[model samples]
Target: MAKYKVTMLKMGTLNGEKSNMTMGRNFGITTEIPMFSVAVEGNGHKIILDTGIKSLEWARVNLGEMYVIEQEEDETMEGALAHIGWKPEDVDIVINTHLHYDHCGSNHLFKNAKFYVQRAEWEAAFNPVENQQCFYFEELFGWSAVRYTSWKFLDGEAEILPGIKLIPFGGHSVGSQGVFIDTEDGVVCFAADTIGVLENLYENCLPNIMTNVEDGFKTFEIVRNNADFVIPGHDPVMKKYQTTDFPKVDKIR
Candidate 1:
């Protein structure tokens, strides 16, 4: 057992007045256009979650041409980590909420780390193309930086690793999922794109894209009702609720 420090590193931010697209049906009214990931430190190990989007070049051809991204802090992941006194290779584990381009583009950045992805997502992502607007594509592969990949094949409350539990939540994707960290601030669930933004917390619904909107709603309810800190997809409000409480996320100086 271990304790973790979770920080929302601002990977990129979308600057537009009408950021929320009219996502109809189940999901509705998303707020903010920010991409985030968590940095974990403690237990004599370093871990991070969801690498965030790639350079806008990849975004231009794939993740909707309208999805323009600007670097929030450093030019590259390595440079960004150095600002906080970490190295790309320092990360021991990289969690994949799902394989969407925006969420996993930087997966290769942590070259020496082992990747933990949901079995369903890993299967779906590598299989035939699913979405016409699929954020990830074959073009994004062949980086060769990921030393290894593992799957959470079996379910029923599995611990992804020490202090991190891979709870089940198949939304956004067939096996789209999230993480529950017994962090210093309590359990922080990384519901990647599972809930597009904080609004999903209140609405308790998901868009038609989700495999099962009801399941998505139920998943959201579970995370929102139980976790100490709920990390929603693309929500910028994380920067505010965060404090210098954990190691990787907290100030080292």
Candidate 2:
């Protein structure tokens, strides 16, 4: 097995209703949500888990005031990559946990990398349900400049590399997946929207934004069973676990 080093790249932050992340709880509270892209390095390859949002202007014009999205000077895709001494072209693979605007917004940057997306996700992205339609932006991934040959659409669980795997569990969306990486300590699962915040997993609460609450809880168990350390999709606490000491202690069972 090839052990890899994982780094969480801060893409930006979103200010939104806490209920959006914790389901029925925190209905009247607002919070700052951190967005990230996981960088996995090892096995002589460099991979990016997600690509953050496009830009503040793009978000404002497309998403409006539903939430305030902001990216610091060092949080752009390029900036974040540079912070880790990486360039877009240097990326060997790019795997998207899902195609929501925030997760795939910077897809256009890594022209040299092979992109991996679930077959279901690729289909749903184009014909998403009414509510999720707002989060799927074609301009980001459907640009004329990107070649079709760059994509590898998966069907289910797949070990893309020696120790990196893709786990698909549609709940947050019609086709949301999570990335599993082998590390020195154990397996680390980048539980995307399926585990949007720590509360979702700890409290067994589904995010109100999910497409299927049942599937959301199943995904939670998936993380608990497989991951020694779990990283939530948009938790501010993620800042402390940029590397493999993830979550401070072993993930909650």
Candidate 3:
């Protein structure tokens, strides 16, 4: 196809400002994070990755429950789209990097769009014990328009549209995937929460947590080296990578 444009849409902000107790000592990790809704504008197709936060219903209901992390803000997928001058329905395809709450919760918002998921990820969320939340699988069902567009596990590289492709970076989750799209400027990869912050690269360290540590490290290097432009997950650095006013997305040589 012709040239394409990739834009990082800020969905909203999440307050992860609260401190978590690890080994009884107070760890000072900032809680508030910038949620994002990434888009790929190809010749005639548009593909989106990871629909940001859906709502705080789960946190509000399970306030004191363990594992119920509360977010400081409530920027739904719809709000992010509105801010970008687009509608949730305008997205042609949706990619769920993994089944994590923050990543896939907004899948419901794009009920009309075709869903693309890794085969292993879909099955992991499909099986009873393998699944975490019911909505993980339920949200994709009963929607007459929904379809398992492409399975990344079986099909290593599947182009989302023409220029938008899914890169399997497994191990973060069973089938945690990354997206690589060729834009008019250069190659941009939607690396969902893999090497979260720029620091995730500086030290060449894993997140201290992962489904598969070894695999995570290897895949991380590949992502870091391959993409001409890497848009990290959760961090606000995507749009703020360069000058504030100009927002120049510099291509790595």
Candidate 4:
């Protein structure tokens, strides 16, 4: 097995109602959530989990009203990558856990990388119904088409590299998938929106934003059973494990 080093890249942050993240629980509380793009290095490959939101304007135009995104001038996907001594072109693979605007917004930056996404996610991105419309942005996909030409649409579980896998579980999005990476400590699962915050897993609460509640719960169960360390999609608690200051990256275990 190939052991990899995982780094969580802080993209930016957002303020939203706790209910939005914890589902039916904590209805009135509001909190700030940290956005991240996990970088997995090993097996002679540079693979990124998801490209965080592109820019403030992009967020404002697409997701601001819903998520209330707040980004500083320097908090950019490119800047984050640079902090890790990497450029977009240097990325070998870009794995999208889902196609929500926040998750794939900066995908256009990785022009030279092969994008791996779920087949259902690709379909939904192109043909989102009313319930899924708010999450998928046509503009982002249009921009991505122009920059990223390589795409590998997957159906279910797949081994992208030795000790690296993609497990699809349609919950948060019809095509939401989690990336499982083999690491020194054990397996680290980037559960993505399947488990949006630490509380979701610890408290056994599902996220409010779910396409399929049953799938969401199942996804959480799968992650808990398989992963040694799980990384949630939007949790500031992740900052506690950060090992690098420049990129604000966190180690999973």
Best by TM-score: 2
Write candidate 2's Cα lDDT for 1-253 as tens digits. 8999999998899998989998778988889988988899999999998898988888989899788987888788898888889999999899889899899998888879999989898888888889888888878777452467999889999999999989887689887888889999988889878888877888788877879878887888878887888888899988822785676323555
Rank candidates by TM-score, best first. 2, 4, 1, 3
CA lDDT for candidate 1: 0.63
Best candidate according to lDDT: 2
Where is model 3 more than 4 Å wrong at Cα?
17-26, 62-74, 127-154, 240-253
lDDT of 1 at 5: 77
Give all candidates' CA lDDT scores: 0.63, 0.85, 0.59, 0.80
Q: Give one digit per residue, the lDDT tens place, for model 4 in 1-253.
A: 8998888888889888888888778888878888888888898999988887878887786664777877654457788777788888899899999888788888888878889999888888888778878888766656534344588889899998999999997678888899988888778888888788877777778888888888987887778777778888898877722533312112322
* Model with the higher TM-score, candidate 1 or 4: 4
The TM-score obtained by model 3 is 0.76
Model 3 agreement with the true structure over 80-120: per-residue lDDT tens digits: 56655668778777777766656766777675677777777
Q: Provide TM-scores for the models.
A: 0.81, 0.95, 0.76, 0.90
**In what order do the candidates fall by lDDT, top score first?**
2, 4, 1, 3
Off by over 4 Å in 4: 143-149, 240-253
Worst 10 residues of 4 by lDDT: 244-253
**Candidate 1 residue-wise lDDT, 84-146, digit = tens:** 678987888877777777677777677667777766666666673455245555444333535
Clashes of each: 2, 0, 5, 0
Pairs that collide in candidate 3 are 15-72, 16-31, 16-32, 17-31, 17-32
Count clashing pairs, candidate 2: 0
Model 4: pairs clashing at backbone N, Cα or C within 3 Å: none
User: Any runs in candidate 2 off by more than 4 Å, and if so which?
Assistant: 143-145, 248-253
C-alpha positional error of residue 92 in candidate 1 after TM-score superposition, expressed in Å: 0.7
